[model samples]
Target: MSINGQPEKVENIYLTTLNEILDSIAPQNDLELSLNSILKILAKDLHFQRAFLAIMDPKSEKLKLSITHSPAKIDHVTYSPGKGVVGRVYETGQAVVIPRMSENTDFLNKAFGRSDEELKSLSFICVPIKKGNSKEDHNVLGTISVDSPILPMDNLLEHKQFLEVVAALISNQVSRLQEEMALQAQMLSQGPLLGGQEVPPPANFVATSKSIKQVLRQARQVGPSRATALLRGESGTGKELLAEAIHACSPRRDKPLVKLNCAALPAELVESELFGHQKGAFTGAYQNKRGLFEVANNGTLFLDEIGELSLDAQAKVLRAIQEKEIQRVGSEHPITVDVRLICATHQPLEKLLKEGRFREDLFYRVNVFPIFIPALRERREDILPLAEQFLEIFSKEYDKNIKRISSPAIDLFTQYHWPGNVRELKNCLERAVLICEEEVIRTYHLPPTLQTAESTATDTSLSFGEAVAKFEQELLVDSLKKARGNMLQAARDLRVSYRIVNYKVKKYNIDVKKYTGAKKNK
Candidate 1:
């Protein structure tokens, strides 16, 4: 029964252990218990010193240790993508086999306190839990790994294949558990509103800026009414967050608040997505489905990126708004819908109308109570508070004790223009939290772009007006240097009038003749 010099007894042990693991997992059984049981069996049968499972958090993009077989109690541990051998396996969607853990530089034993002498004799194997059959899909669900001192280098390939099989067997169960967790979270978010209680705005909606506060006030005022509102703002300015807040404050808070992104769907399916489709309405339509309008009856339907809708789709949307009814595709009867509409877009509807891309009639219907959300850069005062908020979230998420951002890091955050707005700031803070090992986040923890901007700026402590003036002066001097002290050329380079450039040169008190002589000699 033995293929190699290894005894057939060991091969039987592997098969028996795998079959037992498979039998232990049932649909009704607790997911964590089943996973822990499997890990325990692997540790015992394979003589592994340690076995563990780490699941990926889709929101924070961090791997959280879920189950471990070691006797020592290891509290919650998390790893960023590409941080260690386990992270590398998750990131690359490939199994890794390290015959000697000590020789591998990528092996980080920070979570488990294994001594250097112990690590030198240990071997490790990690495989990704993928959702799809094809390697091209590369949709990794999580990772499973085992380490032991008894694993022989010659049998490493066989162990790797065996672990990959185990990962494949458990992938579907892991995916189901993750989906259930997400659904539970969504239901909890809406639970208070459903219980006939007034739910306050989400705590994450941090707005100290006067402009954003005014926007929130306007949203609260318009929430009780049935009028369709338009949310106009730049991308990543938290328009969707405002929409959710409005829905929470509305009288129909108990009802469902369905959201759809117009840009995410195709033109052909837009109509069917907004308005329900009957069976046989199109190819692959095996069953009838309720559209967003029907699902959001007596509630709110927030359409994000509304400008991406086609003209035909726009007509159908306009009809739904004006008539308060939607006819299902391939059906004759028009179903009455009492859904409140809230549309958001980053594009200029006026320009779309002039270009004949958007219908003018539809514009007036949805623009009844227009609320404009200011970008993050427009409200620089709120940057630190938002950063601190994100830092707390990510710190807890990664199981790190990071307390605060350093003063230098805060200065850099304020000086940089957040092109992606609040979303960018949130991501930046998440990254800083991941990279920072200390209790405080420093400037080096931030992205290189923010660091470069901070290095180039002269003084971040200046008031907003003074900072703007300094920036203007620097721009004028740099332009003059490039134009060889010619004010007219500098004006053309800087895209300003010659008179204004001359005034800026005198205002900054620059020596233009030095540059002129250098250019003349060249």
Candidate 2:
């Protein structure tokens, strides 16, 4: 039924036997269950001693035994790349079939604890399970191996070929399950905040700096309370992310989280947007609509750019906080709300209050629990960690294979003063991932803002050893150019022995044909 299609019979019995084995596994979706059933079938119908499937862990990059069925129930087994037969298959993407396990020197039988007598009578078959369809575009996920009894007239090559077909049929199932299980396992391990240690940052938040960790610690401490929190930071400093973190770990996490940007709306519509308006209340108020406060009842409300709210809207918000009620525009009826307020502003409220632009009563209410988020340049240590996190995210989003940032690019990242903060850094990395076509993001691939005199310069002498090597290589090349690629004359011109010149030429791996004007080799 497969592309390997109906194999011609070596004899009557073997042909029927191979067909039964192939028919038993029909590409089921439940990978572990299918593997368990395949092991039972191989043990019963084919007299196979043991069978196991090893999958590569994406995080650790180590091969771990994922599924096995035998007398000893093993939870997990790890093998370094190119350690034994199974490891060899995973590394080289090649099949290995041995007549006797005892004769193979690399067979470490340490995981299963097989006896010497059992090893002497058993054969081994290991084959790689790759992802892509073609040989040039595939990644070897892991290996499938089995132990068979060393009986008379048993062809190991036939068994190896059969196992290879089975591996190809189930490669997709293996990749999906491994990633899901890894993510679930991580979520379960990061339980609740314990002791007085640094609180874990929520998803989409990266806080490796001491300044940012302090902000998270305060957020965790005040999240459960019903107090109003005022987040202070510069523009693009991720104040919204901090507000979401507080809401995610709070008691009202399951309820709706309503967000509004005060500066984004027009000044005249600020009140109607926050507390709603009745039908025909204003020029465009066609019908009655529920405001953000009603939607955020028994939940949290994130007001970004809160400093930009008009004075009339500020007084109404203060009344909502003090009395737990709001009146829609053009309506005197009071509607109660039970919302936990979280306000963020990149501007200083003290300056606004001094200028009579913000209400003093509302400022005191929201500023009860204050947390100031630092700018990206203030926490320079988090540059690379945050950049790498963004690199991985955008690589998957754009379906690009850009792997890592080069050394020169990393130097530019840490040295640049991020006037636009974390949001700007995220955009820069996303652009880099989109434009980068290689396995690594070089300095030339970064944004123009990051392309400084240092990064874009063509100086190869960045170190003492590098400068010496550059000087020495240049001297040797000049001597060769003058001597027409003749080693003996080049050594005489440079006042060195021919043997020393020969060693330096090979050390630099220089080709002399261009310098010789396409002359014959000496």
Candidate 3:
């Protein structure tokens, strides 16, 4: 094939490309999915002839082949210990590379039974994977082998080294997964908390979606520790609320949890806000004032929009975290503070780092543990429950008798894509509850955008209509509510005549006499 009219294929898989693929699969909670994605990328995207991993079955104690490339059909079930190249790599815990498959007697044509012509040009590479990271604890559990027939002869060594790096990554992931599964099993065996009641999720947060549940799991895991948590998501996705959950479940719950928005403060006042200034620090410094770092001593300090901090502010924050102390502005005295830091950002810190706007050192310091809040559009399962919760909250606050959302209103609630996430949903429910005169909130009582076709312009599928008559009916009802069901007064408030108001009220089947006896808002 190399001597034909076509040029030879080169092996040019870079480490960066491999890392990018692994990074994507890192978030996957399923072990089978992660392994399939790894092999799929190797065969399909990396242009390999065949790729597969042979993991040892725990009960059978034999190396069994996993899912392979779609083009190749291999019927071999399990390899005996120290038998073929695959078994030899697993038994001895060392990788093996065959420059020419047909030349080696251990090539084992019985495994795949390819033609001699194909075996003459094919190169085989197998790398053993260990169960743990330490070399002293070498428990060979599997082997990831690849058949790269199209590669040039000189690139075999580089490819072997690349496979070793991949095997190391596989080892790390397997070890972590095994430990996590063991811990979970042990916890479940301990049973529920006191009174047989299940441990409730974080307070004031609904986690119906799997994505948000995973975020909550990650947050609670790091709560008791002093590790800095980085909450990442788009604006209004409740990063601040998640910060509160982390602190509430943490050991610092007894201490005061200080909060600050890095973007809300002026650039000149950022340092003074983070680290206090002396009484005579600057022209405006009349009296000594402690900063957030000092105020949140022995507690959690949540810094929202940390990405908006200036480069100089980032440097000082990094120092405070590293040294466990901070120097106030225009003051040389350093005060020690024991604070648990939780940083949040809606902006991409990596993009800012590459653009020279953010310090790379500070970026690494705060990115220790990251929890991403799924956007409302991605977690639609939580919408109805959240809407109901907000409905109850606003009803009590506004002294309204609103009980539930109507079926049509619920349909519109789930159909519309919330761009502002939980914050927007809260506001939408609050508005709906306030305007709702009847026990239930109707579709017309919702925001105008939700009823229009604009809601469908985004990711949603509903291109619902907004009827002018429905809106006019709502206006008439509201005016009647304000006027205590009096026709002349309601018409004056609506800027229409009494005859037109009476016609609309009768046309919409409105019972004007009921509102007259009920207590109304001022």
Candidate 4:
């Protein structure tokens, strides 16, 4: 039977796979069972004698087998990107059809223990499983190989095409499963909170700022309660990250962390997308859809950019929050959703509330635990560390050898007003990495805005090193003042350690202790 010609069977399998994937998207799945079944189905339907899935090592560009089964071998086996026929196929992104293995010089006989005399009788088909660019980059995710006793290679093209299609399917499911499993594993590792309602914290969260520390403390304090949280910040100040941290520390972490960007979805579809719709609910509503609230039942619903929601959608969202129930567009039955709400927005909600734009009641409901993320300019101490983080991130991202920022470049970054905040800084570093030809990013690699400021400095001959020291002094003084002479608080505010802040205070010769008069209470 020709695998490609079985259109009805293939269609059924595809539909079944899609449904399974969609169901797996929800949090109520046993990931291991789902993955095991997915692999089994793919292997069976593809008629492969042996099938395996591997996850690509991001740094090494090598495939390490994650799951597999063979009649001869019990489980998956390890293979590098250039090892055997499987590796060669994955590395080259081309199908290898070896009718006679002994005749093929490219064939590596490590998979089969048979000698050249015994291998000459076998035929094999190896294909690479990859996404996005299936050609050229050979960003090989994994590979699938099928072998049989010496039989004439029949319809090699058709078999190769079928293998490629199956490879794409496997890639999609495997990537999704990996992400879900990783997230779930993290959630499970975090111990339960005091109350049954609080979620745990995400492991990747890093905080050096007192404001962030206090925010986390507050979140932990009230996370077990049913209070709504509002995260206020500039873009890239990690509002979403804070939200995730809150969710991880809450009781709802076991369920879904449903996210909705109010500004991203169209206004016309906002209501439907958030509240979902029943069949024939509107013009194109042919199927019943579950909204974010329902999807996030017994969990958290993170509404990002909440200030961007239209008035109508806002009213609907408010009702949903207040009543703990949502009415689908065409369905009268109100579905109860036990979800903790977390919202974030760059817009000033108080001003919007005063202007009658944001609903007062809704604002009150979500503002129970409001936390503000200080901009990069406000927290000057975080600049260097954040820059270092970005340098590491983008260096690995762009595969560049850049290790550090020069004194001049660091000065330019420190002096520039980061109006766009942390998000903009990351973008600048990413672009710099792409264009920088040297081992380090210099002032010239920075954006023109930053470069212009350094160029126009009054004391250019002071040396970039001296200029940087002066800037650091000014920044330290400003931060100390902002913290009202509380050195620990100031250091925390700057995302720097107490020692560093104290050292800077001594270096600048600022009598911070003297400034700690009556203003220390605030």
Query: For this target, which candidate reaches the highest TM-score against the unseen true structure?
Result: 3
**Candidate 2: lDDT of 451?**
82
Candidate 2, 84-165: lDDT as tens digits: 8878888888989888999999897856888889899999888898873435323888788889988543577877777777
User: Candidate 2 or 3, higher TM-score?
Assistant: 3
User: Is candidate 3 or 4 superior in lDDT?
Assistant: 3
Query: In candidate 3, which residue ranges exceed 4 Å CA deviation?
Result: 1-199, 455-522
The collision pairs in model 2 are none
For residues 1-522, write the lDDT of model 1, one tens digit per residue: 243546667668779889989776754356778888999998887778899888887656788786787754457788788889988898899889998888988888856888888788888899999874547425888899988774666677777888888888887667655654543444344443334423334658987777887787777767766767799999999999999988988889999999999999888898899998999988988889888999999899999999999998899899998788899888888999999999999999878876889886677567666799998989988899899889999999999988766655777898899999999999999999888997778778999989887444556589999978866776676556556788899899779799998887888888888767444211
Cα TM-score per model: 0.50, 0.52, 0.56, 0.49
Residue 9's lDDT within candidate 4 is 53
For model 2, the superposed segments whose C-alpha errors exceed 4 Å read: 1-193, 453-522
All-Cα superposition RMSD per candidate:
24.3, 27.1, 9.6, 23.6
Task: For each candidate in the order shown, give its overall lDDT on alpha carbons.
Answer: 0.81, 0.79, 0.77, 0.70
For residues 284-336, could you state the per-residue lDDT of candidate 4 as single tens digits?
Answer: 99999998889888889999999999888889888888788998889999998
TM-score of 2: 0.52
Per-residue lDDT for 154 in model 3? 54
* TM-score result, candidate 3: 0.56
Ranking by TM-score: 3, 2, 1, 4
Error of 3 at 193 (Å): 11
